[model samples]
Target chain A: MIRLDGVGQVFDGREGQVTALEEIDLHVRPGEFVTLIGRSGCGKSTLLRLIAGLLPPTYGEVRVADEPVTRPRRDVSFMFQRPALLPWRSVLSNVMLPVEIEGDKGRAAYRDRAHELLELVGLKGFEGRLPHELSGGMQQRVSLCRSLIRDPQVMLMDEPFSALDALTRTELSGELQRIKMELSTTIVFVTHSIEEAVVLADRVVVLTPRPGRVREVVDIDIPRPRSLGRNAHLTEVAEISGLLHGLLAEKEARPVDEVRP
Target chain B: MTDTKRSWLTTSPVAAVLLPVVGLIGAIALWWLATVVFGIDSYLLPGPQDVVSTFLDQPAYLLKETGTSMIETVEGFLLAIVLGVPIAVLIVRSVILERLVYPLLLMVNAIPKIAIAPLLVVWMGFGQWPKVVMVLLVCFFPIVISTAQGMKSTPVELVELLRSLNASRIQEFFKLRLRYAMPQIFTGLKVAISLAVIGSVIAEFVGATQGLGYVIQQSGASADTSLAFAAITLLSIMSIVLFYGLVLLEHLLLPWAQETR
Candidate 1:
């Protein structure tokens, strides 16, 4: 459902031009859960931004649903590391924000969907509460509901559960999998954690740091409802996680000319 | 103290009200004691009772003057919000306007407001216009600066989320930036309101026949030290009331702001 062809991003920094990403080619199938993982300064988030159309790629092109993405499209939604909720709005109001922004005529229908999304995320009684009243996990769940409110064709999530405590993070990852089973939306999630990438992604895209390029795309063949603890697929999860860790830790001394893949 | 008792003292609604009152009474008692012990001349520092009696003697006149000052302060504060918020929006929306107007705003804000009080009176005459203008001058900077800073400080993720949803510039602003900046904008408003009161008084000090500032000025000329003290007390009361009024408003309007930060 999404394609990036030779996409690159160059930022003008204080000292000189900083290439954030380079010579990137990626494709995400419809209903696929693709997670991008890399160390800091890897431009994983930059790639996501290019696809979201928040920032145009400095070179090449991005297409979603076979259309060139010159700007943000109506069928895609993005979520962030932080909950980023509007502090003055109640949870329900915040979930309805996208609909309100679109000035959609069927607000009542959207409102009902908002409640259902909130309920799906186990936030049934929090419609009247503000973002501050929620725990970190709960707030992120609210954000999830918000992004899902429009029932977009694609959702781009950047480290959505990384800010939570370890237990809450695991819990949320499980819940995300459950939610994904019920919704057909394609997802491109970015994360720093190797375990998280293995747990959530159908394919994990490893990216190199500094002028980021796609290093490897590892397809996860593990079954659904997979767990990190005492599960049938624990060995597979550990194997994939270790491989990603090694890839991230390698400090290759390749020449600049040889760096491009 | 018992744990529950200590918690009650810290958290009880009654304690919140009583503690400040006790502090005020203690402050008044210290002042009364100092006057009696040092045998200080009433001309220099009137006793609390002397000030109270003076206020009692002509409550009607003093209240009328207070009403006039209140009118000027409210008008100027409202005007500042009306003008300053839009200017802030304009500055945030366009880089060219921001660069052009930012330095000019800073230059205007840097010139001592009191230095311009006389000029305001020269331009607008001895009527309420000068006082209102003075209040606006002092109040404008805080509102504009805080609002601009707030708009600029919106989390990058939130902006991207809006953009990814295909929200228009106007929707991104009203539905996201404006609402997100509210807590900081209220911070500016609180600062401006206090300055608003002081600004009106400063204008009254330069040339006015009414207001608490004028009353204090008149009392100074007549050597009515007790009356001056009464007027000063009223001024402090006015400042306190206005500040708390805003606090209450913010609490009611943006209940999420207090806990989110």
Candidate 2:
């Protein structure tokens, strides 16, 4: 449902121009889950931002549902690593914000859907609580509810679970898989974790840092409801991890370019 | 952590009550001791007891003057809140608006509002309108600065998340930026409330025949030292009450903010 044709992002820095992404080409089919994996500053997040139209590409084009994305479209939703919950709003209100912002004055219109999203994220009983009152995991769950509340066709996530502890991360990874199955929305998620990418994505696009370009796209042939336990798919996860590890080593070995001159 | 301790202190009403009551008592004792030991002249500094007596003697008049001063303070403070938030939002929305308007705001704020008090009196005449306008001038800066800073400080992650959701600029402002800025806005409001009261009194002192500032002026002319002290005491009370009213309103409107960093 989304296509990036030679998408490149160049940022003007105090030292000079800095390229974040270069000639990147990507396509995400409807109901597909794709994860872009890379080390910090690999432009994975930049690619996601470009797809979400938060930032326009310096060159080439991004298209969603065959429409050139000049700006953010109503059918796309983005999730961040942090919960990004508004501290002043209750969980339910935060989830309902998109609807309210769309000037849907009728609370009755989206209330049932919002409630269902919250329940899907396992935040049913805590809708009235403030973001600050919840644990980090719970806050992120509230944010998930918010992102899904509008029932968008596309979901772009930038390391949405990277900040959580190992246990919560695993728990959320499972919940996310369940959510994906239920929602059936196209997703482009960015992550630095190979294990997470392997478990959650149908295809993992690995990139190198600084003028990031796709190094490889690894397909995960493992079945759904996957876990990081002693299972047959564990070998597949290990293989992907090894591939990611080699790319990271190569990324580190590349001599740092001095852009001052 | 300091935050934990603060939440603990505030969460328990008994502790909250004790801290302030103890602080007030300590301040009063210091004042009483300084007056008695130094043998300060009543003309220079009336004792707290004498000021209280003066207030009691003219309770009806003092109350009426207090009401007049309060009306002007409230009017100006409310006007500033209404105008300042939108102006701040506009500045945040556009670089051109910020560059064009920010320096002018600083210039207006820098021109000692007390100096404008007389001009306001000359233009508006020796009435409540001049006092209200003067209060607005003094209070406007804090509201504008805080609101602008708050809007500017909307978490980058949060902004990215909203953009990913295909939220419009207006949606981002109302749902995310505005809500996020509430705590900082209240911080400004708390400061502006006191300033508003002070501004009204200053304007009245410059020109007027009623209210606490006029009472101070009239007492000054007649060399009624005790009455001047009484007026000053009433002004102090007014300032405290106005500030606390804002604090109370903030607590009511944003209970969640109390726990935030």
Model 2 per-residue lDDT tens digits across residues A1-261: 998888889999999999998878878889999989888988988898888888989999999999999888878888888888878778899898788777766779699988888888788898898888899999988888888877889998989999999888888888888889988999999888878888899888878888788777777788888864435578778887887778777835353232111
Stretches of model 1 off by over 4 angstroms after superposition: A253-261, B1-13, B33-45, B94-99
Task: Assign candidate 1 its CAPRI class.
Answer: medium
Give chain A TM for each model in order. Answer: 0.95, 0.93
User: Candidate 1 lDDT, tens digit per residue, A191-213?
Assistant: 99998999889999888888798
- 10 residues in a row with least lDDT, candidate 2 chain A: A252-261
User: Residues B128-158, candidate 2, lDDT per residue (tens digit)?
Assistant: 8998888889999999999999888878887
- Winning candidate number (lDDT): 1
Residue by residue across B152-221, what tens digits does model 1's lDDT show? 9888777777777777888888888887888899999999999999999999999898998899889999
DockQ for every prediction shown: 0.70, 0.59
Model 2 stretches astray by more than 4 angstroms:
A103-109, A229-232, A251-261, B1-49
Decoy 2 TM-score against native: 0.87
Q: Candidate 2 chain B, which ten residues in sequence have the lowest lDDT sum?
A: B1-10
